[model samples]
Target: MKTLIILLFFSIISIASAHAQSNTPAKAEQEIIKLSKTKWDWMADKNVDSLSTLFDEKAVFVHMGGSWGKEREIAVIKSGSIHYKKADIHSVSVNIIGNTAILLNNITLLAVVGGNEVSNPFIVTEVYVKQGKGWKMGSLSFTKINQPAQ
Candidate 1:
């Protein structure tokens, strides 16, 4: 009877551990989604200081008109050259592979570039890498979608 009880207890612990492991990925996915939205908000607000911490030093950004590294991206944001007025996020999804997370956000972005207001639909891909206790954005690319925003 004691042996049976011990086995049962062990089985319960194993099941609990497995459940916890399963939830971990979901939690991470949610975290990545939240971070991605926050990034859009920061960009719209031109909060370069906050964005600087979230962006990795070796990060790259690809816009429709150009591609650049972290320093140039930060400079552009600071200068309000291409002001991110708003990001209407329609949908977001996240995929986790090892220590890297890929987030895709379908959005309608309103921007003021060259003193002209423009809106575009895009699929924004954001790549984040786990760095110690936090995650840093390593790459961000916007691919313009032919269809209109839903």
Candidate 2:
């Protein structure tokens, strides 16, 4: 019985993964894209409460200057240390792998850091994991782009 149960679970996982890899962007892909866009708005507004709910407990955030976990990220936003003024997204793409989603956004971000306003192009990568009925952000990483935004 135990062996059979394990095999069944693996089969389910295999089916889920295969389904997620389909070329057509399905509802799940749309959902992830929308979630990522909303996340930008939350950051711009400094809505730590909403962001806190979206981010997983073990979420990791990576920036040009440093990298930190969820708690520190919330603290930083709440303290107004790095104010996300706006994000002008050029393009966005998402790939769902089983219960995990990887989203990429090419954007030009306007932010106030250390009381100085700056704008920079970045390729932001967001990883989300579906837990229960909702998705939680597991990682957010920003990679600066030297070229102009397309």
Candidate 3:
């Protein structure tokens, strides 16, 4: 009877541990999606303050036409050279690797650059690291989708 009780207790502990581990990735992914949407909203409105909160201290951004470190990216947002009129994220995929997450998504940005109108479609990949209390964007790389404009 003692052995049976001990076995059942161990089984329950194992089951609980497994369930907790399984939910962690899902929770992390959801947080990442939320972050992405927040970024899009901030960009659409040229909200520098909001965008600043999403980036890590050491984030790196490889934009379609250029690359920028965290400081420069923040400066760009502050400068407000290009206003994001609309941003559409078509699909998103998330992969958890240890304490890091990789997010892939297809995006469309409608904006004007130097008074020239443009609609940019891009394939974006971002790596996020779980910080002490939340996830911070570590790196972001994007490539322009090369199809003739309709």
Candidate 4:
């Protein structure tokens, strides 16, 4: 009877452990998606303080016009060199691989650049890495899509 009880307890523990492990990726995905949306909001509002925390010091941002590091990206946003007026997200998906999370967002971005407003459809790839207790954006790239926004 003691052996049976021990086995039963071990079985319960194994099942619980498996369940928790399965949910971890889902939780991370949700977090990544939430952070990505918050980034868009911050960019539109020109909230560099908030963005500074979210972006890693060595982060890279690739825009249509040019690619730059975190400091340059923040400076441009603050100076309104490329104002991100709005981001109309069509679809978003996340994939977590080990300690890195990759997020792809299909969006139509309305922006003012060089005193002219333009709208463009792009598939934005955001890469995040686990840093201490939280995740920080390591890289962001915008790929202009030839197809229209759905």
Candidate 3 segments exceeding 4 Å error = 148-150
Question: Model 4, range 1-150, lDDT digits (tens) per residue?
Answer: 999999999999999999999999999999999999999999999999999999999999999888999999999999999999999999999999999999999999999999999999999999999988799999999999999666
lDDT of each: 0.95, 0.94, 0.81, 0.95
List, residue by residue over 74-148, the lDDT tens digit for candidate 2. Answer: 999988899999999999988888899999999999999989999999999999999999999999999999996
TM-score for each predicted model, relative to the true structure: 0.95, 0.84, 0.89, 0.97
Pairs clashing within candidate 3: none
Clashing pairs in 1: none
Best by lDDT: 4
Q: What's the CA error at residue 139 for candidate 3, in Å?
A: 1.5
Alpha-carbon lDDT of model 2:
0.94
Of 1 and 2, which scores higher on lDDT? 1
Q: Sort by TM-score, best first.
A: 4, 1, 3, 2
List the candidate 1 regions with Cα displacement exceeding 4 Å. none
Better of 1 and 4 by lDDT: 4
Per-residue accuracy of model 1 over 57-144 as CA lDDT, tens digit each:
9999999999999999999999999999999999988999999999998999999998899999999999999989799999999999
